[model samples]
Target: MTLQQRQLAADTPTRFARALAVTISLGCAALASMLLAEAAARDGFSGWDGIRAVLVFVTTAWLAWGASLALIGLFGGRTTALRPDLHAPQPRTVIAVPICNEDPLTTFARIAAIDRSVARADVTADFVVLSDTRDDGLAGKEQFAFARLLRETDGAGRIFYRRRRDNSGRKAGNIEEFIRTSGGAYELAVILDADSLMEGDTVRAMIARMQSDPQLGLLQTLPKIIGARSFFGRALQFASWFHGPIFTRGLARMQGPTGPFWGHNAIIRVQAFAESCALPELSGPPPLGGHILSHDYVEAALLARAGWKVEVDETLGGSFEEGPENVLSFARRERRWCQGNLQHSRLIFAPGLAGWSRFVFLQNVTAYVVSLLWAAFLVTSAISTLYAPPPEYFPGPYQLFPVFPDTSTREITLLALGVLGLLVVPKMLILLHAILLDRARDFGRSLRMALSVLTEIILTTLLAPLMLLYHSRAVVQVLSGQDGGWPANQRNEGQLSLCDGWAAGYWIVLVGAAIIAAVQWLAPDLTIWLLPVAVPMLFAPFLIAWTSLPLNRVLFAVPEDAAPLDVVTEYDSICDVWRLTWNDEHLMPKATSPDLTHATA
Candidate 1:
């Protein structure tokens, strides 16, 4: 480490800033809870009203805490001053891409693109393709694709591929195995998902950051979503390109010295990770107990516990990852994440964890837990309206004319508006910032940006209930000891048929119908208020199917859709070549590498 880097690592975030983040986050949540309690009491109090008020407090507090982060991100200081100089010496780094049953052609093509990018920058980095594919046929295909990658990029020595027979610990195990065998050769490792693509300069910049902060264990980059074609994917792309920066910046500020590792598309110090991140399995069986499924968070916590800084650099760009193209695909991914996050419940109180690390576990826990809470709130509100007695305005010995009850509709409306503001103002602030900074052009300019935001809001709102149900189910299943086993990501897969979409979402739609019917039969007056939540449930299937289709992608077009990235364009061509030409008998040249000749032999 350089003298300057060592000096800077000595100065972490001040206690005052950490306290401020906690104060603002909790303080806002507390104030929002107080307001919700007051609003609930505006109508004469009841036990049911009290329950509603409590749920309101918990849910709104969660929202407020998020808002606080974004606000801090907007107004907080940055680490730009601590950034490493570009002309400084570089370190030896290994870029690791973990792949399972993925499309070998597309995955290796992406690696080729990344390898070329790194080669162009003249950086001393090796790329490794670690495969955990259990299927022999798919593994063979991956080997052939790796050979193609080697031939095409002329990366025989610099790029390597290895597949494991037993997919024991999944991606985490794959990485750990690499670290044990080959990690000694490099100072740092840039971990990437199969779909990850980092520009050569971004890779160099991240390495520089690591070199500048010797105590920095991991530096996560905010990767913009690329190559999205469906409406769902495009919306995500636009959000990531535009609003994602603000969110990540806020998270970075609040995280200070202890940020997060999102498993891939980030750089990590080899020595620190190897020493601190050897994950331990919790004793027991499936879902709730076993090997740590979400190993990234635990690894970060371990690093912080060992007094290493894990920070995220949101200002750095040119890193990219693909998103699921449709809602069902997204739900499938979320199902796995849901189990992983829920699994952290057991580790929340693990010994010697930093306070912030523990809080992060809670944050992951809340991400899915809030959906259940929201669902419960809806159910309780329905029950309260149906079975609970009418408001007792004359509870006391009031002598005068019996007081009349009022729902305080105006106050309720304003409260709803306040809650909406908390939920959306951060996004508005992001939009305003982009416009003011002239960054709106990156999202297709102000007019289209506004339209895209509007479309995203509508689509997300319609899809929220479905997600809530999906998440709620996943959590319940996990809690009931059902494990969501490792599933390969179906990147950019075809759309589900209407029947398939319906099959995936029938339970959700049925529950929505049941809730609406129950509400209408018990309390007709409350049905209107319930429509916002209930209507989405009924239309869940249609929403999933519609968003899954390639149609309407142009309607909410993203900047990438309008003008594609070079890597994305190249990847498409490579996919066509592999798909159409792989089966041709003589595609492989006569005198290939010995390893390739032997593997195919």
Candidate 2:
């Protein structure tokens, strides 16, 4: 370890914090495994039961690790601040917004709003639209929009737009190209997605932090979901508003120097990034080979390897991004992410990566793998029951697999309940913590926040099976060598008709029906027990359509709306005026974003 990292490690509580989190996770996993193994060993402990026990450990460990992070944040108290929250930005910072097959009007208006924000703050920052758009028709629209945007924002030299005809490397490549060509002019770069938005103050804050610490290579801010209108969208917004911070805080405490970079809504030292974050194509073919899929995580690891501090600051607000308004869009994005993460398996042994960075890759892979493991466990459970032998009432002392004297039903019920508790308890605690700390009033008082939490929990619970199926499919596709290519995200009007939902989810329905039919004939007794898992799948199409519909803001009114950020309000006003103009000219479709409409109202 370098002297700087050693000092930071010694000064910070990252070691103790990580150790505690892991110990808690492992302890819970081991206990749950023993209980599950005892419960499954009812008729006879077969090789299948042993295999299940191992799977249970891995799956439970993943769940418990997540819960532990939140628990740590709840009790861990005050995380250390590495930067002094500097306010003055010394040199010009380029705001690089990477785009590919996106809405030009909505995209350019954002640039206008952000330009106004920086101009208002009197901070020296430039906006660069690094376009990787492929469609010729859309490329022309981008030109028109860029011209109009320049006129609207009076951005002659301050704002720039460029589209690459040869879009080879995608988003990462887009950013890298800019750095290679125009990066020398700027000292700092604030990278953002096409949908990402940030307040002038927040940009100043991140720049100040970077300026304050020369060793800081990258600074990531927690980008909250904004402008979500649909039911699924609002639920996500609430979860991010209510639950995201706690988890983010926990992660922030542990990620001392080698913290994460989530691609966008972050600031990076141009020199450091240019020198350290260049990625090489991995040897071999597609899926697990070729170009790195999730380049942000790899870049963070590389920066750390180069002896630069990479940190995430969740406390900084005014950073925001739009999300897919429906489950289909969300799943499509998740599928791409799954492939990206699984592709990292090849880099686990890549030399010079920090231990945590290596573990981060494993964590990503296991996240999807746990769903598969759960699927495997269920299948194994059914087989073990089918081939049951006479119960071993008299087992040897100090047996490797315990044979319980009591009814296995009770043990199994307890184990199941424990797993559910692990999934739920942390969220309930976060809500309680919010109330106790007087933070719940921000979301229209404790009562409404309570309702939001309950409603979100119930909704997420119903949707869990569908999401599990989606993730399982993603893992299978990646493993079977199917590349989930860069799919364009659906950012606006996320509603899905029943037909559309059905078209997307018919296979899920079929899979659910198949499981139920298989179990009804083979294991008649367990048929009722499996309804919770199967019923959701059967109704997934309807659920998807339902959740995609818009919801009243009364229920999920965000704290951000309570006191609007400068950038958010600016963007909304610009959107309202632009929509008015577009609708008048009959050149664009109407229906301004709900978040924008609500804020403007």
Candidate 3:
């Protein structure tokens, strides 16, 4: 074998060894946490309930997630059996790309690209640029301009545009209107996010799968991040590309026909959606009422509740979307998600919900609760530093009597390890999958990839305390009836700001600093336990911004196939052409109708 091949082989084992070492360490920590909980229980520690609850939640999540993987391995291995072949002669389908207040030109370009891509595969699908932009002046003009441009482009014949005069449920309303007015003509409807793209083959596969499985109401693909242009964005893209498949596979295994709908990059059986997926107006006040902020989960639940299947096809590759560009954008997106998940608490307790629906709701609630717990754990650690009892400098009479009190430091350390294991093991497992499946090539050299993973973990470890802080704060804000207004995120490429950092990252830093000071003053010998929390806190702002950078651009560079736009130049050219053609044979002047003459007479 050549030296390069030999070096590659040698490198593989080293990488695998590192992965194995981390995996073993995490597993040992998980086990130790369980044993500590059991020991604490036997000792009748009054505060063990909280520790036990955390351990139980952690262990249950781990096991439940594992069981999900096993189920997918057993049942989902044959998932292709469930998908239909769209290559056969099939009825015409309509692909709807929904847009609200967005960059209309970008939105139209994406729709055009998707249309062209699908057409290249010889897939005859109608394209609908569904706009829910209200009849407000600016948005209305943009929509009209978009419609005119689309008609002048290749989409003139096959593409259609519809703008709602009254925007009701936003996206859900927009989709419902299309169904009510024009859905009857299509066999299926594939929904695409304004920023999403699907390769022609993947789209064909989805349609084929739907055709084969008449029982399948929705087939959603895992979307890869493709256009991130910052450090954080690159990390997110790498992490998503590496870890997303495992979680998705696990989720799909457990979900069956009750999987989630992320509101985009999925195909739906039109009749089934119309019949079963109508979203109800959520009751109560702001944040939880009027319209569902998270209509996707609820819609999926409603579909499953109505006996229609909703499944995620993790194998459907080449589907892509953009991630939030920075920390502020991430928080804005997460805040809305938090409110939506919290609102699920009501539905969780509501009677008559299916078992899987309840499970789905519980999953969403647990996500928010877990964020709060991480924050709580940080607080508890800090308090323990300040309030915990010192070691016995002298042996007590009880020592002579043969009974010994347990060490609080050991217990706290074990608890900390347990939390770390829960967070880190999943990533290690994903990395293992990457190596074993020969997918590490996409991440650069094995050494660099390993370094990247280590860097990501270290960076993420530091940011965890901060994320907990922001998410907990957001959760509290929502619960207290505060509104997180809809603001367009800052997409400018830039460094972290002190104000933005404090808004999203202050909690971890403050908490970590407090812990360190308390440890120095109260428990000098136990300061070692603060390392995990301290590193992240010290570099909270940089780490927060760096990890949240638009990473997609680095991982998946823009393809040569992408279309570029010069907005000002294009508009001028379009205006000149329209003016010259105003009196042409195929054109009719505005306000020159028979009704005008009748009114004048």
Candidate 4:
């Protein structure tokens, strides 16, 4: 009695509710954009002022739109629960764990934990370690780790491993090869990243949803960050735990059946994926052309085009993934994603795509393109100040002497408040919602959660200028025909040396210094406004190094960090055993050292 054999009613959000949510979202964006344009044109509009105003309005409105959705979700009640037939036997699902040159020991331990979890729930599934490693040394290490994981779990036939010879299209190609070669044996394919870990119940629930809704081509789970070490990673973890749910719920409601696939922690109907998702090489060279770097979004669009429902179920919990420990690693990952997103401009008008799908593509591209707009705004502002003609109030035919340009401080202040409200109000709403729902305990209680949110706001505010510069440079490089080749993710990229940090962020510091000098020399009034962004750019290296350390964990301890999940605890215990098993002294041991196991326990 596989899950496909079960028949259950699928309940979706009412079309009116979905439409109203979108209307609120777009309405907020339109209001903010108008306010921003008025603010930009306050000091008498000029030719260059038009561009700055348009850019500010678009970027501000875009952000406000997201914040509006989150605010709406906070008041929209708990997520809609979709009942599934859990009593039916689980279907034959393949757990595809894709990897490259990641830490094999950690990867294998995560796999073992997931395997044990599914077995505990008595789900019928198989685990596959699909490696796209081009390096022979890393490939050997992966195999050794995989063998140890198999032995420890007593998994011989249930788990398998395969490394590709020519890592042609990277992860997308790897999965495609598997789908063509081995995906036929299973009805559902649960795609996972090297760092993904899902609880047995989470996996079963996702499968049941797909089975209940035969029209569902893909089901995505919201993966929370777990097992963070550094202050940066922990802060990100806390923020995601606290605020991610509200935004995700809003997004889910808006998406309806046409949702996003984040490349992992998602299950796809094998037959549908094979039929709709054979990505063709874009007709050009590299960077903005060539093979698609970001394939997940395109796949979702194709599936929707082929009449399959792709949804994100934010209500489902226990799906987890690890995040980068420092800013440098995060920037590196963002660079690749930035290039992939820009490539979508060519496919935006692909034939037969849904309107929402096209909007999604536009949104994805804007995620990175906004950086360029910010940089342009800053440059044009400075130029406008440096080369401005003195305000001449007396007209040619007027008899009066010189009259000063009138400044509307109250109107400007009101516009500033509007922007600030859009930025900060949603977080406050989410906080109130959490308190009302008695869910503050999950984030270290009300007081601690409030403190954490404040800290996150401060840290992100300080880091925004540094990120702006980094993203702007990435966009420029990609536009100039540069391809950021697929690089393996380093799971435990620990620290940022001062030199490395300076090398990565020196340009931002220089630009910040130059801007401060220009503003103070030409436009003294704007110097106060520039300090917030400039100071952070000047100290980016120190901030990066400081946040990469494990210091101040007690100050910002999230609920998960304060006390980890049971599966995390079990994974840690398993990792300790494997660590000793890989040690030279215990090289020949068939079983893990008793003392080591007892020590972890």
Could you estimate the TM-score for every candidate? 0.90, 0.93, 0.78, 0.91
The alpha-carbon lDDT assigned to residue 41 of candidate 1 equals 66
Q: Rate the local accuracy (lDDT) of all candidates.
A: 0.77, 0.82, 0.64, 0.77
* Displacement of the residue 546 alpha carbon in candidate 2, Å: 0.9
Superposed on all Cα atoms, the candidates' RMSDs to the truth, in angstroms, are 5.2, 4.6, 11.4, 5.5
Candidate 4: tens digits of C-alpha lDDT, residues 13-58: 5344456655765666566556545654556667776666676666
- lDDT for model 1, please: 0.77
What tens digits encode model 3's per-residue C-alpha lDDT throughout 65-155? 4433533433343335344556567767888987765544445556655665676677888888776654354365555556655765656
The best candidate by lDDT is: 2
- Give me the displacement of residue 256 in model 4, in angstroms: 0.6
Off by over 4 Å in 3: 1-44, 48-83, 87-89, 134-141, 144-152, 350-352, 381-415, 488-508, 518-527, 546-601
TM-score, cand. 4 vs. native = 0.91
- Please give the ranking of all candidate structures by lDDT, highest first, separated by commas: 2, 1, 4, 3
Residue 187 in candidate 2 has what lDDT?
93
Clashing pairs in 2: none
lDDT by residue (tens digit), candidate 1, 1-601: 4342233231344344556666765666566556655655664456877787778777877887777777767777474635566554578899999887676666788888787778776777889999887767668777888888899888888899998878787788889999999999999999998888888878888888888778889999988887777778888777787777777887887677778998888999999999888888778887877877788998988988777889888888778888878887788788888888888888899887777788899989999999998888888877766554566767778566677775656655666677778867877887787789887676667887777887887888788889889999998998898888765455446477778878988998899999989989988877887788889999887888888766554455556666776666666777677667777444332222222211000
Which residue ranges in model 2 land beyond 4 Å of their true spot? 1-12, 77-89, 390-406, 582-601
